[model samples]
Target chain A: MLKSINVPRHDRVPSLIPDTQASMTRQEIANNNWEEALTFVALQRDRSAYAELFSYFAPRLKAFGMKMFGNEQQALEMVQDTMLNVWKKAALFDASRGCASTWIFTIARNVRFDMLRKKQSRKDDVSADDLWLNGEYPEQEADTDASQWDTQLLMEKLAPHFASLPPAQREVMERVYLQEKSHQEVSDELAIPLGTVKSRIRLALDRLREALDGARN
Target chain B: MAHAIKFHPGMSLLEQHAEGSLSADVALAVAAHIDLCPHCQQLSRDITADLACQLTQQPVKTNTTDWQHMLNDIMAQPQLSKQAAATQAQLSAQAAEPIIVNQREFVVPRALQRLAANHGKWLHLGGIATAKLPAGNDYHVSLLYISKDTEVPQHTHLGLEMTLVLAGKIVDENGEYKAGDLLINSPDDTHTPRTMADEDCLCLSVLSAPLKFKKGLTRLLNPLQQFFY
Candidate 1:
């Protein structure tokens, strides 16, 4: 029924990491500022530190891509591009609002969303705020939005800018967009336990809401 | 900000910007999203910061692109006339072209680069290359390349080995894994693996020790030294 290798030890995250929960735990994340991390890494050119972050993130991004597109090539490409962007824009990581993982995922989410939009023949510039708020509504219903007086101002009011988001959270957003797929499909595609996907999506959405409200007020 | 909500695309735009991979216009769209949704906006900033931190660590030595070689290649291009261009277009019309391998980044992502930098050199087998990495004193990290149509001998093992199919597909006791399939092996498991006839198999694997042969002739070669590469 299944192929098996010898009884060697194995792990989910590479054995290199100590205290894996430091990333999982929100308090730990609070202590670990992504902006500060990026700045420190940038100043030192510390390869090991970079490798640690990559080890933690790349596989998840790969997993996300695989689930989103169901194509290995595209998945690898997505992770590659995501990492490359991280390299080019390390100077931009800000620790004040969120953690590192959330930021990276948003990037993956945005990339896949664009792929879907190209096929959908939609106009440019969808905001995260709109996606969260407006995505719940059927397309035609949101058409006559009351705040349509000044389209530009409405857009500004509706959309908030994001630089990067972690892979897990991004996967949640991508599930609904490009795949034109359901949340369950997203879980199946990523091979993650379905509940994990739901939780992450809610978590990501909550963070997005907070960010928007903060930006507004 | 159009007729449809188009929620996830906004997310995708964020991903593109975070990765620094989006075309200019697509980026503008996500920027607008961030302008409205701070939740994603904040998340985007954090992840971007993390990625940036990781990038800052990459040694700058390689940042010096091989421009000279690139320019030389460009200069060395065989300039074909406009007539050749027409001929090329005609050839494309006649036959289906092959898919291209797209690897734009010079260094593989940090997550994957560890597969190389931290692990051992690639060991080349018959068209199929294999490498064993030192995960620990007992554990091993392996990279396997099974060439098209090649049949691996049925073998059992004393330890557990887990394989994550990275590229291509191979069939054995288990089902087919195109990519992103995590196949875990326990002790006493055995099987003969054959690569999909068309493409070679590339697998990133973790193993504990040398495999113990269960079936036949492939066991004989265990003692004799094979190609180092």
Candidate 2:
């Protein structure tokens, strides 16, 4: 169940890659154009496009699941379930609402939640209504290019922003967001007040907002 | 943006909704609110993307055998025809229309439409009316209607009570709750909810347990609290 990848802990050593190498890698990924790949799967059921998406996202999703669940087998299951949903619900992808990454990420998040709930023996009776609301989709048409560009730019900035977060804020944010733990749970784990836990999360989010807005401007 | 709801669900609730940790009933209420609130919608999107970006950076151990099996499963599934797709879209669009009770019409939030068909019989209680909605797991849900200028007896919840105002205004000690406002009250809260004189108020209330009436005369209704449940 655990196929260990022998990669170095590059997240801890952010400067291992030279600036030029990092930028080139970012450029290459941006050039792959996730939206077009999703469109291919949606319209043509293209195997190669699906394969491309699977190769890119499945591994990352597994990593994300492991971080959240701390179990390799469950993480693999999460990756499998998320990819299955992507294949089954490809046509539901709406570029007008968001980019491919945003859509897929939302799916992965929801899938993880479902798995957690099922593990706790909770009933799953939420109708489709609990998923999306309102007839008016967020109209990104006016600034589609700008927003898409911002999304890509933000993705590139994520690591640096995370690395720069204050230690307390970073720990809370990681526990709350990445590990899928509630603020109350984090407070208990860290032996801090719940209010402190919330404040730390808020401060981290504010820093990210400021940094991302700076990038946009 | 004039007359926008002053009170919204906490950011943590929205975050939970985005993360999928919220119960289905609470999530449905939040989804309905998100449809009505742009600020929340944007926040939810931002959080989702941010989480995704962080996850994308993690180095993953790829299991080739599992990947091959998944690919095979995906390939074997049948695809929907264009006609079927169009029809499904049409049906969902039609489902978005407003729900009518007597002469009053309220635009059902897109997320609540699927549950619209299961709305129970409307039971009149003094100036207010309620109809139980389908139970989702542990919670009992109901659509509550308060006539203009009507006041509900002071009450506190037996367990957690989440009320999402769907239309008009409900005033309590906390604040004026208008459409799209979600008020979460635990056992510690006690308040008398009165509607403004201008228009009738509609709200969806999800309760973890039955509400306990705390005031005079209404306390007699406590024995009949099972009725509300």
Candidate 3:
């Protein structure tokens, strides 16, 4: 089931990529083909591709877990569980349907959901995968007509609009998505009202949507 | 005949659902609604894709933990073959059991299938029946069936009350609800929910607290609450 990959690991070291969106040159952004890397891991069982993915995602996931769980041990556990799922569920990834980051993010989110359920000792009859990963309804899958948006182009177009948002809106966006904080938690953390937090998020989404839709038109 | 779905979860709720930040019990209602409503499904997909776009752009803090060892350990584990994954998907699809109520069969959304399979025995009172689906502790999740022309007593919620219509039609003071309509009621809202004279109804109900029946006999209110809870 596995074949060796010829791609060299040194050609795509994730560590060399800069941290900020502004600092990332076009070459770096263009080279970020996590979707293709995942295909290699799936079809070729390419350890080098997997390692490159790990280098790019693990620290970010660690930061994500720390923000969500507020401890190092649980964060590390999350990284391990998420990465393991990435390896095991690689065959399920479809590049045409979605990007690698979104697919990986969903896996990470489901891992966190399961961990939360286990910590609460809740009955495991219904799982996050059942609720999130499966088709919303069995018949609905047959009628799915559109492929996902071209993610690389969307990302490139969205970065400037995202950066230009008001500081409060940008901060709320980061806390909600990156930190995975609930709106209520963000309200409490930022010392703002819940309504304010919600409105800011709404406005931020509107601006980003307009930017993308503009490009499409 | 299928009725066009009119009521849907608000955009904020849809966004929260895509983020996986909503509690499981609440998220179940949204997911099931998305099953029946194509509009929300598309909106949810867009929101999730946008989230992915934003998430990828977030700056990462450098951490020095030995993720190398963790990666090596993960690499050592056996990857699931495509055949095995396909088999699992097939098993789940085949395992979906139709929910039966009052000699009538109702097909629930995929999200509720597993928990609905293990639901408790139906408890009947008057023309209404409810069966508890074991899910979260803080909320009461159940399948509620109301026979034709039956009217539930007027009640106000103490916390949150979310109802997702699965089959047939129901009408309240506000408007008519057909299949795939999700009604979210907070503490301040009070209304009587009833079925049409010619149609029966089935709903997925989630309650944060027991109902407080209004405008009923003082001695009979507790039993009325018990009927639904």
Candidate 4:
């Protein structure tokens, strides 16, 4: 059945993935069994292995989607699509090119933004160069202490910080990001005005973004 | 000058963005933030210098042989048909030149512009024109030059659309996006885009799917999308 038709398992089959039970952090996951895991996913129609892969990246992918779509629900959808591709394209994962996290993150990132590009229909704007630039490259690198482990450690260290935030601010963030609510949705959920939700989320995001950045330094 | 939202892009993101290693979505958001804050731009450059120095420390893995070979495999493998290649070429083209906020020519990396320009003659899609590149996939690379006060009609989308502002500013319900801003719209999101009058705006956009027109006679032209894409 595998070779009767010359179709690569990568294409034409989007399988149902079970939940991943891997106990390792992203780095551990990267160092151990990542390549083998990819090989397994690539060759056989394995559901359990794909699930473990999805479990690790899904939350982070959702977080990224939240940032991009500005809402949690949409972010969830984005992560879903990203993980789906990851499950199917596990065969394409190459450790030499980049770490599994970087590869998966790149895919998730592209998928999230791809949706954004679709949202803004490509028509009728005379000079688009104004609002969007094709060439917005940053020459800057993640110049943290190279002697230390990957920056992922820093982000993990910052995870507990969510508990330290002002309850009000954290609530706003949770509603908007964790819960995937819109500004309006968050407000309604909390019985607060829309502006309050917007201000709280904005202030919370600013603080979090700054604090996280500072921690890396 | 019109109450531009001053965005304070943090140091870490600036570092990652300048590194060109951040995920593209984060990069786009960070780009939007950078567009609003010149302070971030200066800092990003400083960080860029720091990153270049730090790069000296990143040694090739001991076991790794030629890194280029792995990259060659990805590059050598074919993606989608004409749709994917053309699309990637268009993206690579826009990425070639970093969109200078106020420059006439697209300020991209030399490598990218060479690729996009390598594609056949561009198809002018009234307002912003497009060219179906020789690359794979349903890639539609286009340019938009909006004279002051022009409003691009409201429209929906099918697949994915990526826009890179090459000049001026365009405002949708989302917010006023200035030069060097990347405004991405998720699928099914619709908005009326208006370009302020006085200054002509230039932009480059990549549309993955055919657009779904919501109003007016423009819908009639939907079937004949080759010219418009």
* Candidate 4 deviation (Cα RMSD): 16.5
- TM-scores, all models, native as reference: 0.32, 0.71, 0.77, 0.37
lDDT (10s digit) by residue, model 1, range A1-217: 1112111223211233324455455223333444455555444533345445554556667666766689867766666666554544444455443445555665566556555455445442232222221111121222122224353542354234222335656656556443457777875666443444544544455445445554211
Clashing pairs in 3: none
What is the iRMS for every candidate structure?
Answer: 20.3, 11.5, 8.1, 15.3
Here the TM-score of candidate 2's chain B is: 0.89
lDDT of 3 at B104: 94
Q: What does the lDDT read for residue B98 in candidate 1?
A: 22
TM-score of 1: 0.32
Winning candidate number (TM-score): 3
Give one clash count per candidate, in the order shown: 60, 0, 0, 56
Candidate 2 lDDT over A138-157, as tens digits, reads: 64323232224343444566
Task: Report the error of model 3 at residue A119, Å.
Answer: 1.0
Query: What is the per-residue lDDT of model 4 for residues B85-126, given as tens digits with 9 covering 90 to 100?
Result: 345425533434333322345543232243344445544444
> What is candidate 4's lDDT per residue for A107-215, written digit by digit as tens?
5545655565556553321111222233334443432322243335534654467676657768776665556677887756664444345445444444565666652
* lDDT tens digits, residue span B2-121, model 3: 666877777678878887888888988888888888766756765665565555556777556877667767776667777775565445445678999899998888788888888999
- Cα lDDT computed for each candidate against the true fold: 0.47, 0.68, 0.74, 0.50
- Flag regions of model 3 displaced more than 4 Å: A1-32, A135-217, B89-93
For model 3 chain A, the run of ten residues with the poorest summed lDDT: A138-147
The i-RMS of candidate 1 is: 20.3
Better of 1 and 2 by lDDT: 2
Can you give the DockQ of every candidate in the order shown? 0.02, 0.17, 0.20, 0.03
Q: What is candidate 3's lDDT per residue for A1-217, written digit by digit as tens?
A: 1322322244333333234453344224223577788999888777777877777778778877887789999988988998888888788787766667777778777788888888888765456865674422222342222224344644566557768775767898778765779999996776544545655665566557655553211
Ranking by lDDT: 3, 2, 4, 1
